[model samples]
Target: MAKLFGNLELVLIVGLVAALAIIGAFASSVVVDANSILRWLHLFFGVLWIGLLYYFNFVQVPTMPAIPAEQKGAVTGFIAPKALFYFRWAALLTVVTGLGIAQVNGYLHTAMSFTGEGAVNLIGTGMWIALVMAFNVWFIIWPNQKKALGIVETTPEQKAAAGPRAMIASRLNTLLSLPMLYCMVSANLG
Candidate 1:
C-alpha cells in the first residue's frame, strides 16, 4: 500500500481504475456521456487551478515575508516554478474542458452570447469571468512570474516590477473566482 501510494502517477492510475469500475457498476443508474465526462474533467482542472491560486494567495504570498532571506531561494527557485507550471496548464485545461462541456451540451452559443435562459446567462457570466482569469494566468501572471522567479533573465529593477504585477493579476483572479463560482454552482443547481 505504501509503495502504491508513494508514486503519484500510480496512485492516480489506480484511482482512475477504481472510478471506472464504480462507473461501470452504476452505469445503468447514472447518465454517463460526453458532456458528463467533459464536466468531470473541467471540475478536476478547475479544482487544481483554483486550489493552487488559493494556496499562492492565502499561504505562499502571505508567508513569503516571514521566510528567511536565504531560504526564499528554495521557494522562488524550485517550488514556485513547479507550482506555476501546474497552475498555468490547469487554468488552460479547465477553460478548454469547460468550453467543451458547453459545446457538447448544445449551449455554447447561447451561453457565450448570454442569450438563452437564466441558467444559460448565469453560466455565460461564469464562463466570461473564467476566461478573464485564464487570460490573466497565461498572459499576465505567468510572464511576470517567470521574470520575478528568475526563470527569465531580467534586471533587478524589472524583476522587482514583475513580482507585483504577477501578484496583482493573481489577486484579481482570486477576486473573480467568488462570483464565477457562484454563477457556476447556481446555474447547475437545477
Candidate 2:
C-alpha cells in the first residue's frame, strides 16, 4: 500500500480507474456531459494553480527568510521548480478548460463580450480577468521565474531583478484570484 501510494503516476491511474468503474456501475447507460466534464477539469486545474500560487505567496515566501541559508537550496533547487512547472501548466489547463466549458454551454461569446447583463456580464468579467491572470502566468511570471529560480543563465543582478518582478506578478494574480472566483461562481449560480 505504501509503495502504491508512493508512485504518483500509478496512484492517479488507479484512482481514475476506480472512479470510472464506480460511475459505470451506478449508471444504466454511460452518458457524458461535455460541459460538466470540462467544468470539472477547469475547477480541478484552477484549484491546483491557485493552491500553488497561495503556497508561494502565503507559505513559501513568508517562511523563506526563516529557513537557514544553506537549507534554502532544498526549496530553490528542487521544490520550487517542480511546483512552478505544475503551476504554470495548471494555469494553462484551467483557462483552456474554462473557455471550453463556456464555449460548449453557448455562453462563450456572451461571456467574452465584456458587455452584457446578468450572468453573461458577470461571467464575461471573470473570464477576462482569468485570461489576464493566465497571461501573466505564461508571459510575465514564467519568464521572470526562469531567471529568478536559476533555471536560465542570467547575471546575478538580472536574477535579482527578475525575482522581485516575478513575485510582484504572482502577488497580483493572487489578488485577482478572489474576485475572479466570486464572479465565476456568482455569475451563473447567483
Candidate 3:
C-alpha cells in the first residue's frame, strides 16, 4: 500500500481504474458521453494549472525573497523546474480539453463568437479568458521561465529580466482566473 501510494503513476492509474469502475457500474443510470469525459478532463487540467499558479503566487513567490541565498538553489534548480513543466503542460491540456468540450457539446461556434445568449455567452467569456491565460502560460510565461530557471542558456542579465516577465504574466493569469472561474461555474448552474 505504501509503495503503491508512493509512486505517482501507480496512484493515478489506480484512481483512474477506480473511477472507470464506478462509471461502468453506474452506466445504466448515468448518461456517459464524450462531452462528459471532456468536461472531467478539462476540470482536472484546469485545477492543476490554476492550483500551481496560485501556489507560485500565494506561496513560492512571496517566500522566495525570505529564503537564504545559499538555499535558493534547491527551489530554483529542482522544485521550480518540475513545477513549471506540469504548469505549462496542464495549461495547454486544459485549454485543449475545454475546446473539446465546447466542440462536443455543439457550442464551439456560438461560444467562440460570443453570439449565444445566457449560458453560452457566459461560457464564451470564460473560454476567451482561459485562452488568454493559456497563451500567457505557453508563449509568455514558459519562455521567460525557461531562462529565469536556467533551463536554457541565457546571460545573467537576461535571466534577471526573464524572472519578472514570467512573474507578471503569471500574475495576470491569476487575476483573470477569478472571473473565468465564476463564468465557468455560474454558466452551468442554470
lDDT values, one for every candidate = 0.94, 0.89, 0.93
Model 1, residue pairs in steric clash: none
Q: Which scores better on lDDT, 2 or 3?
A: 3
Q: Compared with the true structure, what per-residue lDDT tens digits does model 2 show for residues 1-190? A: 9999999999989987987787678657755578757876888899999999999999998899999999998999999999999999999999999889888878788779866678888889899999999999999999998998889999999999998899899999999999999998898731
Residue pairs with backbone overlap in model 3: none
Candidate 1 lDDT over 28-143, as tens digits, reads 99998988788888999999999999999999999999999999999999999999999999999999999998888888899999789899999999999999999999999999
- Give the residue spans of candidate 1 off by over 4 A: none
The weakest ten consecutive residues by lDDT in model 3 span: 181-190
- Runs of candidate 2 with Cα error greater than 4 angstroms are 26-31
Clash count for each candidate, listed in order shown: 0, 0, 0
lDDT of 3 by residue, 1-190 (tens): 8999899999999999998999999999988899778888988999999999999999999999999999999999999999999999999999999889888888888988989999999999999999999999999999999999889999999999999999999999999999999999988821
